[model samples]
Target: MYKLRELERIDLDRINKWRNDQNLIACLGAPYRYINEDVDHEWYEKYLHARNNSVRCAIVDDKQEEVVLGLISLLDINSINRSGVIHIMIGDNENRGKGIGTFAVNEMIKHAFYNLNLRRIELGVLENNLPAIRLYEKTGFVREGVKRESNYKNGKYVSMIIMAILREDYESMPSLRSENDE
Candidate 1:
Protein backbone atom coordinates (compact mmCIF):
# COMPACT_ATOMS: atom_id res chain seq x y z
CA MET A 1 0.00 0.00 0.00
CA TYR A 2 1.02 3.60 -0.49
CA LYS A 3 0.46 6.73 1.60
CA LEU A 4 1.16 10.45 1.41
CA ARG A 5 3.35 12.39 3.79
CA GLU A 6 5.14 15.71 3.98
CA LEU A 7 8.30 15.86 1.88
CA GLU A 8 11.24 15.38 4.24
CA ARG A 9 14.93 16.25 4.03
CA ILE A 10 15.87 12.63 3.30
CA ASP A 11 13.85 12.69 0.05
CA LEU A 12 16.04 15.36 -1.59
CA ASP A 13 18.61 12.97 -3.08
CA ARG A 14 15.97 10.79 -4.69
CA ILE A 15 14.01 13.76 -5.95
CA ASN A 16 17.14 15.25 -7.46
CA LYS A 17 17.89 11.98 -9.21
CA TRP A 18 14.43 11.90 -10.74
CA ARG A 19 14.68 15.52 -11.77
CA ASN A 20 17.84 14.72 -13.72
CA ASP A 21 16.56 11.60 -15.44
CA GLN A 22 16.36 12.49 -19.14
CA ASN A 23 13.86 9.76 -20.00
CA LEU A 24 11.53 10.91 -17.24
CA ILE A 25 12.13 14.56 -17.99
CA ALA A 26 11.04 13.99 -21.58
CA CYS A 27 7.65 12.91 -20.37
CA LEU A 28 7.18 16.01 -18.26
CA GLY A 29 5.98 19.29 -19.76
CA ALA A 30 8.89 21.13 -18.13
CA PRO A 31 12.04 21.74 -20.09
CA TYR A 32 14.96 19.41 -19.48
CA ARG A 33 17.65 20.98 -17.29
CA TYR A 34 20.36 19.66 -15.03
CA ILE A 35 19.61 20.24 -11.38
CA ASN A 36 22.51 20.22 -8.97
CA GLU A 37 22.34 19.74 -5.22
CA ASP A 38 22.50 23.46 -4.57
CA VAL A 39 19.66 24.08 -7.00
CA ASP A 40 17.61 21.40 -5.32
CA HIS A 41 18.21 23.03 -1.94
CA GLU A 42 17.18 26.40 -3.31
CA TRP A 43 14.03 24.87 -4.79
CA TYR A 44 13.14 23.34 -1.47
CA GLU A 45 13.61 26.67 0.24
CA LYS A 46 11.26 28.27 -2.26
CA TYR A 47 8.74 25.51 -1.70
CA LEU A 48 8.84 26.21 2.02
CA HIS A 49 8.17 29.87 1.42
CA ALA A 50 5.32 29.08 -1.01
CA ARG A 51 3.38 26.90 1.38
CA ASN A 52 0.35 29.17 1.26
CA ASN A 53 -0.10 28.53 -2.46
CA SER A 54 1.06 24.92 -2.68
CA VAL A 55 0.61 21.53 -1.11
CA ARG A 56 3.43 19.15 -1.96
CA CYS A 57 3.65 15.65 -0.52
CA ALA A 58 5.86 12.61 -0.75
CA ILE A 59 4.21 9.38 -1.86
CA VAL A 60 5.47 6.63 0.46
CA ASP A 61 5.37 2.85 0.68
CA ASP A 62 3.27 2.53 3.78
CA LYS A 63 3.16 -1.23 4.33
CA GLN A 64 6.88 -1.84 4.26
CA GLU A 65 9.83 0.54 4.45
CA GLU A 66 8.04 3.88 4.32
CA VAL A 67 10.36 4.78 1.48
CA VAL A 68 9.33 7.77 -0.61
CA LEU A 69 8.26 6.51 -4.03
CA GLY A 70 7.31 9.82 -5.59
CA LEU A 71 5.92 13.32 -5.15
CA ILE A 72 2.47 14.86 -5.66
CA SER A 73 1.53 18.49 -5.47
CA LEU A 74 -1.31 20.98 -5.82
CA LEU A 75 0.21 24.25 -6.96
CA ASP A 76 -1.01 27.77 -7.65
CA ILE A 77 -3.86 27.28 -5.25
CA ASN A 78 -6.40 30.10 -5.41
CA SER A 79 -8.52 30.05 -2.29
CA ILE A 80 -10.81 32.76 -3.56
CA ASN A 81 -11.52 30.82 -6.76
CA ARG A 82 -11.37 27.40 -5.12
CA SER A 83 -9.07 25.96 -7.74
CA GLY A 84 -5.56 24.56 -8.12
CA VAL A 85 -3.29 22.67 -10.50
CA ILE A 86 -2.23 19.16 -9.54
CA HIS A 87 0.91 17.24 -10.45
CA ILE A 88 2.23 13.76 -9.64
CA MET A 89 5.28 11.68 -10.44
CA ILE A 90 6.21 8.17 -9.43
CA GLY A 91 9.98 8.66 -9.36
CA ASP A 92 10.99 5.15 -8.41
CA ASN A 93 11.11 2.98 -11.53
CA GLU A 94 10.68 -0.22 -9.58
CA ASN A 95 7.61 1.25 -7.94
CA ARG A 96 5.97 2.40 -11.16
CA GLY A 97 3.04 0.51 -12.79
CA LYS A 98 2.06 -0.84 -9.38
CA GLY A 99 -0.91 1.46 -8.65
CA ILE A 100 1.20 3.87 -6.58
CA GLY A 101 0.44 6.76 -8.91
CA THR A 102 -3.27 6.06 -8.82
CA PHE A 103 -3.28 5.97 -5.03
CA ALA A 104 -1.34 9.19 -4.79
CA VAL A 105 -3.57 10.97 -7.29
CA ASN A 106 -6.74 9.90 -5.54
CA GLU A 107 -5.38 10.91 -2.17
CA MET A 108 -4.38 14.30 -3.47
CA ILE A 109 -7.78 14.81 -5.01
CA LYS A 110 -9.40 14.01 -1.70
CA HIS A 111 -7.12 16.44 0.07
CA ALA A 112 -8.01 19.20 -2.38
CA PHE A 113 -11.73 18.68 -2.47
CA TYR A 114 -12.35 17.53 1.07
CA ASN A 115 -9.62 18.96 3.24
CA LEU A 116 -8.99 22.20 1.40
CA ASN A 117 -12.54 22.75 0.19
CA LEU A 118 -11.36 23.33 -3.34
CA ARG A 119 -13.85 22.91 -6.16
CA ARG A 120 -11.59 22.45 -9.17
CA ILE A 121 -8.24 20.73 -9.64
CA GLU A 122 -6.45 20.82 -12.98
CA LEU A 123 -3.30 19.56 -14.72
CA GLY A 124 -1.49 19.63 -18.02
CA VAL A 125 0.00 16.50 -19.57
CA LEU A 126 2.31 16.10 -22.51
CA GLU A 127 0.19 15.15 -25.55
CA ASN A 128 2.31 12.09 -26.19
CA ASN A 129 2.40 10.88 -22.60
CA LEU A 130 -0.31 8.26 -23.05
CA PRO A 131 0.15 6.53 -19.73
CA ALA A 132 -0.24 9.73 -17.76
CA ILE A 133 -3.17 10.84 -19.89
CA ARG A 134 -4.88 7.52 -19.21
CA LEU A 135 -4.26 7.82 -15.48
CA TYR A 136 -5.75 11.29 -15.30
CA GLU A 137 -8.79 10.19 -17.27
CA LYS A 138 -9.22 7.22 -14.94
CA THR A 139 -9.18 9.66 -12.05
CA GLY A 140 -12.08 11.67 -13.56
CA PHE A 141 -10.10 14.51 -15.13
CA VAL A 142 -11.66 15.46 -18.44
CA ARG A 143 -9.69 16.91 -21.31
CA GLU A 144 -10.48 20.59 -21.28
CA GLY A 145 -8.33 21.71 -24.23
CA VAL A 146 -4.99 21.39 -25.92
CA LYS A 147 -2.18 23.88 -26.08
CA ARG A 148 -0.49 23.25 -29.42
CA GLU A 149 3.25 22.92 -29.21
CA SER A 150 3.26 24.59 -25.85
CA ASN A 151 6.40 22.95 -24.53
CA TYR A 152 9.77 22.60 -26.22
CA LYS A 153 11.62 19.39 -25.43
CA ASN A 154 14.40 17.39 -27.07
CA GLY A 155 14.76 19.84 -29.98
CA LYS A 156 11.07 19.65 -30.84
CA TYR A 157 7.84 21.12 -29.55
CA VAL A 158 5.02 19.09 -28.07
CA SER A 159 1.41 19.88 -27.30
CA MET A 160 -0.04 19.77 -23.82
CA ILE A 161 -3.54 18.63 -22.97
CA ILE A 162 -5.23 20.40 -20.12
CA MET A 163 -7.38 18.25 -17.84
CA ALA A 164 -9.43 19.03 -14.79
CA ILE A 165 -11.98 17.60 -12.35
CA LEU A 166 -14.53 19.67 -10.51
CA ARG A 167 -16.13 18.97 -7.15
CA GLU A 168 -19.32 17.73 -8.82
CA ASP A 169 -17.38 15.13 -10.80
CA TYR A 170 -15.66 13.85 -7.67
CA GLU A 171 -18.93 13.57 -5.79
CA SER A 172 -20.58 11.58 -8.58
CA MET A 173 -17.81 9.05 -9.08
CA PRO A 174 -17.55 5.87 -7.03
CA SER A 175 -14.56 6.06 -4.73
CA LEU A 176 -12.48 3.30 -3.18
CA ARG A 177 -13.26 4.92 0.12
CA SER A 178 -15.10 7.96 1.38
CA GLU A 179 -13.27 11.24 1.96
CA ASN A 180 -14.03 11.05 5.66
CA ASP A 181 -12.35 7.63 5.78
CA GLU A 182 -9.03 9.32 5.28
Candidate 2:
Protein backbone atom coordinates (compact mmCIF):
# COMPACT_ATOMS: atom_id res chain seq x y z
CA MET A 1 0.00 0.00 0.00
CA TYR A 2 1.08 3.57 -0.57
CA LYS A 3 0.42 6.54 1.68
CA LEU A 4 1.17 10.22 2.06
CA ARG A 5 2.40 11.56 5.39
CA GLU A 6 4.26 14.40 7.03
CA LEU A 7 7.83 14.70 5.74
CA GLU A 8 10.01 13.99 8.73
CA ARG A 9 13.55 14.97 9.68
CA ILE A 10 14.95 11.49 8.98
CA ASP A 11 14.07 11.83 5.30
CA LEU A 12 16.06 15.03 5.01
CA ASP A 13 19.32 13.47 3.81
CA ARG A 14 17.72 11.50 1.01
CA ILE A 15 15.67 14.50 -0.06
CA ASN A 16 18.88 16.57 -0.21
CA LYS A 17 20.56 13.96 -2.41
CA TRP A 18 17.67 14.04 -4.83
CA ARG A 19 17.56 17.82 -4.77
CA ASN A 20 21.16 17.78 -6.00
CA ASP A 21 20.62 15.10 -8.64
CA GLN A 22 21.21 16.62 -12.05
CA ASN A 23 18.99 14.34 -14.14
CA LEU A 24 16.07 14.10 -11.72
CA ILE A 25 16.00 17.76 -10.75
CA ALA A 26 16.14 18.77 -14.41
CA CYS A 27 12.70 17.31 -15.06
CA LEU A 28 11.17 18.86 -11.96
CA GLY A 29 12.32 22.46 -12.74
CA ALA A 30 14.85 22.72 -9.91
CA PRO A 31 17.89 24.95 -10.20
CA TYR A 32 21.18 23.29 -11.20
CA ARG A 33 22.96 24.07 -7.98
CA TYR A 34 24.12 21.93 -5.06
CA ILE A 35 23.26 22.71 -1.48
CA ASN A 36 25.03 21.49 1.62
CA GLU A 37 23.55 19.66 4.61
CA ASP A 38 23.31 22.92 6.51
CA VAL A 39 21.00 24.30 3.87
CA ASP A 40 18.98 21.12 3.80
CA HIS A 41 18.50 21.18 7.53
CA GLU A 42 17.52 24.82 7.42
CA TRP A 43 15.05 24.16 4.64
CA TYR A 44 13.46 21.32 6.55
CA GLU A 45 13.19 23.56 9.60
CA LYS A 46 11.28 26.11 7.57
CA TYR A 47 9.04 23.42 6.13
CA LEU A 48 8.28 22.05 9.55
CA HIS A 49 7.44 25.47 10.93
CA ALA A 50 5.96 27.31 8.01
CA ARG A 51 2.49 28.78 7.78
CA ASN A 52 -1.11 27.96 7.22
CA ASN A 53 -2.11 27.44 3.61
CA SER A 54 -0.66 24.10 2.51
CA VAL A 55 -0.48 20.38 3.11
CA ARG A 56 3.03 19.04 2.43
CA CYS A 57 3.44 15.27 2.39
CA ALA A 58 5.91 12.59 1.46
CA ILE A 59 4.72 9.64 -0.57
CA VAL A 60 5.66 6.32 0.96
CA ASP A 61 5.22 2.59 0.57
CA ASP A 62 3.11 1.80 3.61
CA LYS A 63 3.44 -1.97 3.10
CA GLN A 64 7.02 -1.59 4.15
CA GLU A 65 8.52 0.70 6.77
CA GLU A 66 6.99 3.74 5.16
CA VAL A 67 10.05 4.29 2.98
CA VAL A 68 9.56 7.60 1.31
CA LEU A 69 9.15 7.63 -2.47
CA GLY A 70 8.85 11.35 -3.12
CA LEU A 71 7.10 14.56 -2.18
CA ILE A 72 3.70 16.08 -3.02
CA SER A 73 2.11 19.28 -1.84
CA LEU A 74 -1.06 21.34 -2.02
CA LEU A 75 -0.03 24.95 -2.08
CA ASP A 76 -1.74 28.33 -2.02
CA ILE A 77 -4.81 26.80 -0.45
CA ASN A 78 -7.82 29.02 0.10
CA SER A 79 -10.04 27.51 2.76
CA ILE A 80 -12.91 29.91 2.30
CA ASN A 81 -13.10 29.19 -1.43
CA ARG A 82 -12.01 25.53 -1.25
CA SER A 83 -9.24 25.70 -3.82
CA GLY A 84 -5.59 24.66 -3.87
CA VAL A 85 -2.68 24.31 -6.29
CA ILE A 86 -1.03 20.90 -6.40
CA HIS A 87 2.65 20.13 -6.84
CA ILE A 88 4.39 16.76 -7.00
CA MET A 89 8.01 15.66 -7.23
CA ILE A 90 9.10 12.05 -7.52
CA GLY A 91 12.58 12.51 -6.20
CA ASP A 92 13.42 8.85 -6.51
CA ASN A 93 14.61 7.96 -10.01
CA GLU A 94 13.79 4.27 -9.50
CA ASN A 95 10.18 5.32 -8.84
CA ARG A 96 9.81 7.35 -12.03
CA GLY A 97 8.11 6.46 -15.33
CA LYS A 98 5.85 4.09 -13.47
CA GLY A 99 2.17 4.58 -12.58
CA ILE A 100 3.21 5.68 -9.08
CA GLY A 101 2.59 9.34 -9.78
CA THR A 102 -0.85 8.71 -11.15
CA PHE A 103 -1.74 6.53 -8.18
CA ALA A 104 -0.52 9.08 -5.69
CA VAL A 105 -2.36 11.82 -7.53
CA ASN A 106 -5.57 9.83 -7.50
CA GLU A 107 -5.31 9.36 -3.76
CA MET A 108 -4.42 13.01 -3.22
CA ILE A 109 -7.39 14.12 -5.24
CA LYS A 110 -9.70 11.95 -3.15
CA HIS A 111 -8.29 13.44 0.01
CA ALA A 112 -8.53 16.98 -1.31
CA PHE A 113 -12.10 16.76 -2.50
CA TYR A 114 -13.56 14.38 0.05
CA ASN A 115 -11.52 14.85 3.21
CA LEU A 116 -10.53 18.46 2.87
CA ASN A 117 -13.78 19.44 1.19
CA LEU A 118 -11.92 21.28 -1.53
CA ARG A 119 -13.80 22.08 -4.69
CA ARG A 120 -10.86 22.56 -7.01
CA ILE A 121 -7.37 21.15 -7.21
CA GLU A 122 -5.08 22.64 -9.82
CA LEU A 123 -1.54 22.16 -11.12
CA GLY A 124 0.92 23.52 -13.65
CA VAL A 125 3.17 21.38 -15.78
CA LEU A 126 6.09 22.24 -18.02
CA GLU A 127 4.83 22.08 -21.60
CA ASN A 128 7.99 20.38 -22.86
CA ASN A 129 7.71 17.53 -20.37
CA LEU A 130 5.46 15.15 -22.24
CA PRO A 131 5.58 12.35 -19.70
CA ALA A 132 4.46 14.66 -16.90
CA ILE A 133 1.84 16.35 -19.06
CA ARG A 134 0.45 12.96 -20.02
CA LEU A 135 0.35 11.86 -16.40
CA TYR A 136 -1.64 14.92 -15.44
CA GLU A 137 -4.02 14.47 -18.34
CA LYS A 138 -4.59 10.82 -17.51
CA THR A 139 -5.27 11.70 -13.89
CA GLY A 140 -8.33 13.80 -14.84
CA PHE A 141 -6.70 17.21 -15.06
CA VAL A 142 -7.90 19.35 -17.96
CA ARG A 143 -5.61 21.89 -19.55
CA GLU A 144 -6.77 25.38 -18.70
CA GLY A 145 -4.20 27.46 -20.62
CA VAL A 146 -0.53 28.23 -21.03
CA LYS A 147 1.66 30.61 -19.13
CA ARG A 148 3.87 31.64 -22.04
CA GLU A 149 7.59 31.46 -21.40
CA SER A 150 6.98 31.42 -17.70
CA ASN A 151 10.18 29.72 -16.71
CA TYR A 152 13.82 29.78 -17.82
CA LYS A 153 15.86 26.61 -17.59
CA ASN A 154 19.05 25.03 -18.94
CA GLY A 155 19.70 27.75 -21.52
CA LYS A 156 16.31 28.96 -22.77
CA TYR A 157 12.72 29.63 -21.78
CA VAL A 158 9.93 27.11 -21.40
CA SER A 159 6.17 27.52 -21.17
CA MET A 160 3.96 25.94 -18.51
CA ILE A 161 0.53 24.42 -19.02
CA ILE A 162 -2.10 25.13 -16.43
CA MET A 163 -4.34 22.18 -15.68
CA ALA A 164 -6.96 21.45 -13.05
CA ILE A 165 -9.63 19.02 -11.84
CA LEU A 166 -12.77 20.17 -10.15
CA ARG A 167 -14.75 18.19 -7.54
CA GLU A 168 -17.33 17.40 -10.19
CA ASP A 169 -14.68 15.97 -12.49
CA TYR A 170 -13.14 14.03 -9.63
CA GLU A 171 -16.41 12.25 -8.97
CA SER A 172 -16.48 10.90 -12.53
CA MET A 173 -12.92 9.51 -12.70
CA PRO A 174 -12.70 5.80 -13.38
CA SER A 175 -10.42 5.33 -10.42
CA LEU A 176 -13.04 7.00 -8.27
CA ARG A 177 -15.70 4.55 -9.44
CA SER A 178 -15.80 0.81 -8.90
CA GLU A 179 -18.22 -2.13 -8.77
CA ASN A 180 -17.33 -2.46 -5.08
CA ASP A 181 -19.06 0.79 -4.31
CA GLU A 182 -22.09 0.46 -2.08
Candidate 3:
Protein backbone atom coordinates (compact mmCIF):
# COMPACT_ATOMS: atom_id res chain seq x y z
CA MET A 1 0.00 0.00 0.00
CA TYR A 2 2.96 2.30 0.58
CA LYS A 3 6.63 2.54 -0.27
CA LEU A 4 9.62 4.63 0.77
CA ARG A 5 11.17 6.70 -2.00
CA GLU A 6 14.37 8.66 -1.77
CA LEU A 7 13.69 12.30 -1.13
CA GLU A 8 14.56 14.16 -4.30
CA ARG A 9 14.93 17.87 -4.85
CA ILE A 10 11.33 18.08 -6.00
CA ASP A 11 10.17 16.85 -2.62
CA LEU A 12 11.74 19.73 -0.71
CA ASP A 13 8.96 22.06 -1.77
CA ARG A 14 6.27 19.66 -0.66
CA ILE A 15 8.01 18.94 2.62
CA ASN A 16 8.56 22.61 3.26
CA LYS A 17 4.88 23.22 2.73
CA TRP A 18 3.95 20.33 4.97
CA ARG A 19 6.10 21.70 7.77
CA ASN A 20 4.28 25.01 7.60
CA ASP A 21 0.98 23.32 8.27
CA GLN A 22 -0.07 24.25 11.79
CA ASN A 23 -1.34 20.80 12.74
CA LEU A 24 1.78 19.01 11.56
CA ILE A 25 4.24 21.30 13.32
CA ALA A 26 2.19 21.60 16.48
CA CYS A 27 2.79 18.00 17.43
CA LEU A 28 6.50 17.95 16.80
CA GLY A 29 8.89 17.97 19.74
CA ALA A 30 11.40 20.04 17.81
CA PRO A 31 11.20 23.76 17.98
CA TYR A 32 8.66 25.23 15.60
CA ARG A 33 10.45 25.78 12.34
CA TYR A 34 9.55 28.00 9.44
CA ILE A 35 11.11 27.71 6.03
CA ASN A 36 10.79 29.28 2.64
CA GLU A 37 11.82 27.89 -0.73
CA ASP A 38 15.34 29.29 -0.45
CA VAL A 39 15.87 27.65 2.92
CA ASP A 40 14.68 24.34 1.55
CA HIS A 41 17.00 24.68 -1.40
CA GLU A 42 19.89 25.29 0.95
CA TRP A 43 18.91 22.34 3.09
CA TYR A 44 18.83 20.06 0.10
CA GLU A 45 22.24 21.24 -0.99
CA LYS A 46 23.88 20.86 2.42
CA TYR A 47 22.19 17.97 4.22
CA LEU A 48 20.23 15.87 1.74
CA HIS A 49 23.13 15.69 -0.64
CA ALA A 50 25.72 15.16 2.06
CA ARG A 51 24.46 11.76 3.24
CA ASN A 52 26.78 11.98 6.20
CA ASN A 53 24.69 10.35 8.92
CA SER A 54 21.07 10.07 7.85
CA VAL A 55 18.64 8.47 5.45
CA ARG A 56 15.45 10.29 4.45
CA CYS A 57 12.55 8.98 2.44
CA ALA A 58 9.12 10.07 1.45
CA ILE A 59 6.22 7.69 2.04
CA VAL A 60 4.31 7.21 -1.20
CA ASP A 61 0.86 5.69 -1.34
CA ASP A 62 0.47 3.38 -4.31
CA LYS A 63 -3.30 3.67 -4.28
CA GLN A 64 -3.18 7.41 -4.68
CA GLU A 65 -1.39 9.57 -7.26
CA GLU A 66 1.83 8.29 -5.77
CA VAL A 67 1.86 11.48 -3.77
CA VAL A 68 4.08 11.59 -0.74
CA LEU A 69 1.78 10.60 2.08
CA GLY A 70 4.45 11.70 4.52
CA LEU A 71 8.07 11.14 5.44
CA ILE A 72 10.02 8.54 7.46
CA SER A 73 13.71 8.80 8.16
CA LEU A 74 16.61 7.54 10.24
CA LEU A 75 18.65 10.37 11.69
CA ASP A 76 21.98 10.52 13.48
CA ILE A 77 22.92 7.05 12.27
CA ASN A 78 26.10 6.22 14.13
CA SER A 79 28.04 3.50 12.36
CA ILE A 80 30.11 2.94 15.50
CA ASN A 81 27.06 2.40 17.68
CA ARG A 82 24.88 0.81 15.00
CA SER A 83 21.99 3.01 16.09
CA GLY A 84 19.79 5.75 14.67
CA VAL A 85 16.88 7.92 15.69
CA ILE A 86 13.55 7.62 13.86
CA HIS A 87 11.97 10.76 12.49
CA ILE A 88 8.53 10.77 10.88
CA MET A 89 5.49 12.80 9.99
CA ILE A 90 2.27 11.65 8.31
CA GLY A 91 2.10 14.81 6.08
CA ASP A 92 -1.53 15.68 6.42
CA ASN A 93 -4.08 14.99 9.09
CA GLU A 94 -6.44 13.63 6.45
CA ASN A 95 -3.89 11.01 5.44
CA ARG A 96 -3.27 9.99 9.04
CA GLY A 97 -4.99 7.31 11.20
CA LYS A 98 -5.48 5.22 8.08
CA GLY A 99 -2.50 3.04 8.99
CA ILE A 100 -0.23 5.06 6.71
CA GLY A 101 2.11 6.17 9.51
CA THR A 102 2.32 2.66 10.90
CA PHE A 103 3.03 1.22 7.48
CA ALA A 104 5.78 3.73 6.74
CA VAL A 105 7.30 3.29 10.19
CA ASN A 106 7.34 -0.49 9.95
CA GLU A 107 9.05 -0.37 6.60
CA MET A 108 11.69 2.12 7.79
CA ILE A 109 12.35 0.16 10.98
CA LYS A 110 12.69 -3.05 9.03
CA HIS A 111 15.20 -1.43 6.72
CA ALA A 112 17.04 0.11 9.65
CA PHE A 113 17.41 -3.20 11.48
CA TYR A 114 17.83 -5.72 8.69
CA ASN A 115 19.19 -3.71 5.79
CA LEU A 116 21.21 -1.04 7.55
CA ASN A 117 22.00 -3.50 10.37
CA LEU A 118 21.30 -0.89 13.01
CA ARG A 119 20.95 -2.15 16.56
CA ARG A 120 18.75 0.53 18.09
CA ILE A 121 16.12 2.99 16.86
CA GLU A 122 14.68 5.73 19.02
CA LEU A 123 12.42 8.80 18.89
CA GLY A 124 11.20 11.70 20.97
CA VAL A 125 7.57 12.71 21.28
CA LEU A 126 5.96 15.79 22.75
CA GLU A 127 3.92 14.84 25.77
CA ASN A 128 0.73 16.42 24.47
CA ASN A 129 0.85 14.40 21.27
CA LEU A 130 -0.99 11.40 22.65
CA PRO A 131 -1.84 9.94 19.26
CA ALA A 132 1.82 9.80 18.23
CA ILE A 133 2.84 8.32 21.61
CA ARG A 134 0.24 5.59 21.27
CA LEU A 135 1.32 4.92 17.73
CA TYR A 136 4.94 4.48 18.77
CA GLU A 137 3.98 2.01 21.49
CA LYS A 138 1.77 0.04 19.13
CA THR A 139 4.70 -0.20 16.74
CA GLY A 140 6.88 -1.90 19.40
CA PHE A 141 8.71 1.08 20.89
CA VAL A 142 9.07 0.87 24.66
CA ARG A 143 8.86 3.91 26.92
CA GLU A 144 12.45 4.67 27.81
CA GLY A 145 12.12 7.92 29.76
CA VAL A 146 11.21 11.61 29.59
CA LYS A 147 13.03 14.95 29.49
CA ARG A 148 11.38 17.23 31.95
CA GLU A 149 10.54 20.76 30.79
CA SER A 150 12.44 20.21 27.65
CA ASN A 151 11.23 23.21 25.69
CA TYR A 152 9.16 26.31 26.06
CA LYS A 153 6.87 26.36 23.07
CA ASN A 154 4.16 28.86 22.38
CA GLY A 155 3.35 29.70 25.98
CA LYS A 156 4.31 26.83 28.29
CA TYR A 157 7.01 24.27 28.84
CA VAL A 158 6.44 20.80 27.44
CA SER A 159 8.13 17.57 28.35
CA MET A 160 9.65 15.32 25.70
CA ILE A 161 9.01 11.58 25.95
CA ILE A 162 11.81 9.35 24.77
CA MET A 163 11.00 5.92 23.40
CA ALA A 164 13.05 3.22 21.75
CA ILE A 165 12.86 -0.29 20.29
CA LEU A 166 15.96 -2.41 20.46
CA ARG A 167 17.04 -4.63 17.59
CA GLU A 168 15.92 -7.70 19.54
CA ASP A 169 12.54 -6.20 20.34
CA TYR A 170 11.88 -5.30 16.71
CA GLU A 171 12.93 -8.71 15.45
CA SER A 172 10.59 -10.44 17.87
CA MET A 173 7.59 -8.55 16.52
CA PRO A 174 6.70 -10.71 13.55
CA SER A 175 4.20 -8.25 12.15
CA LEU A 176 6.58 -5.28 12.02
CA ARG A 177 9.66 -7.23 11.03
CA SER A 178 8.82 -8.47 7.53
CA GLU A 179 7.71 -5.77 5.14
CA ASN A 180 10.09 -7.04 2.50
CA ASP A 181 8.28 -10.36 2.35
CA GLU A 182 5.20 -8.57 1.17
Candidate 2 Cα errors over 4 Å, as ranges: 179-182
Q: Which ten residues in a row have the lowest lDDT in candidate 1?
A: 173-182
Candidate 2 lDDT for residue 36: 88
Best by lDDT: 1
Tens digit of lDDT per residue, candidate 3, span 68-106?
889888889999999999989988778988998888888
Model 1 lDDT, full chain set = 0.90
For every model shown, what is its TM-score relative to the native structure? 0.94, 0.90, 0.91
lDDT measured at residue 34 in model 1 versus the true structure, 0 to 100: 92
State the lDDT at 37 in candidate 1.
Answer: 86
Between 1 and 2, whose lDDT is larger? 1
Please count the clashing residue pairs in each candidate, in the order shown: 0, 0, 0
TM-score: which candidate is best? 1
In model 2, residue pairs whose N, Cα or C atoms come closer than 3 Å (at least 3 residues apart or on different chains), thus clashing, are none
Better of 1 and 2 by TM-score: 1
Sort every candidate by TM-score, greatest first. 1, 3, 2
